[model samples]
Target: MYSLTLEQDNRATVSAAIHSDRLVVACLCAAWCGTCGSYRTSFETLASKHPDMVFLWVDIEDHADIVGDLDVDNFPTLLIQRHDTVAFFGTMLPDPAVADRMIQSIAELPDAELQRQAQSTAERRTWQSECNLRQLLNAPG
Candidate 1:
């Protein structure tokens, strides 16, 4: 799979996708995170399975500006966007069972759900260092 390596500063591109029809899976990771290292292959494999979607691996610590826009308090988080809107958001590596569930759930989501999810994500953009990290965690189900 041809996964994308985007600079943390590339919100223009991410935002542009929000105005299009493609799905975007942005993985927020840190270079030093062991979990991020372990999940690379699985992430790539999953990216291959969904070729129509754009898969991005972004290093949060390095791209603080872009990370600031995402309210990402965890090391390896997955934000799923469809039709330029976030439909599902969660944080678990590429566990096959979890991935399957995420795929199945997203496949059935309506545009209204996508819109609501997207708006909530956009509104929760606070990145203070002392902010409650638990606020950003989401389960696939």
Candidate 2:
């Protein structure tokens, strides 16, 4: 397990941490955020269990530009990456049970399988958005 103490000076470290054989779980947080402060301990505990994966805690204020590609509008956001590509992105608080479930799922998956699933998920999201847009356009004014 990797515990990354992120700061403005360590932006490059964060980028390097994600490119691993094991999945990467990057928690984008802020020091002043109450939710982030409270969840930090639990997040660390969860990280210990997933020894194969890389776990990082990135403060948004310090490294906002590095994580700017991620639309982290909320604190305590999680970015899951496998093979340097994002597998999941969300702003859910720390929960060891949920963490265990996700780590277990990712650990069991092979690179090819995970890539296929990610592609499938992206395609579904694109299709859903397109369908909604088409429906809105076709609706009577």
Say which candidate scores most in TM-score.
Answer: 2
lDDT values for all models = 0.59, 0.66
Off by over 4 Å in 1: 8-19, 116-141
Error of 2 at 114 (Å): 0.7
What tens digits encode model 1's per-residue C-alpha lDDT throughout 37-111?
887777888778877666777787776644545655565687765653555555664475576578657756787
Q: State every prediction's TM-score relative to the real structure.
A: 0.67, 0.76
Clashing pairs in model 1? Answer: 18-84
How accurate locally is residue 43 in candidate 1, as Cα lDDT from 0 to 100? 80
Tell me the spans in candidate 2 whose CA falls farther than 4 Å from its real position. 123-141
TM-score of 1: 0.67
Candidate 2 lDDT, 14-40, residue by residue in tens: 556655466777687888999899888
Task: Point to the candidate with the largest lDDT.
Answer: 2
Error of 2 at 12 (Å): 4.1
TM-score of candidate 2 against the unseen true structure: 0.76
lDDT against true structure, model 2: 0.66
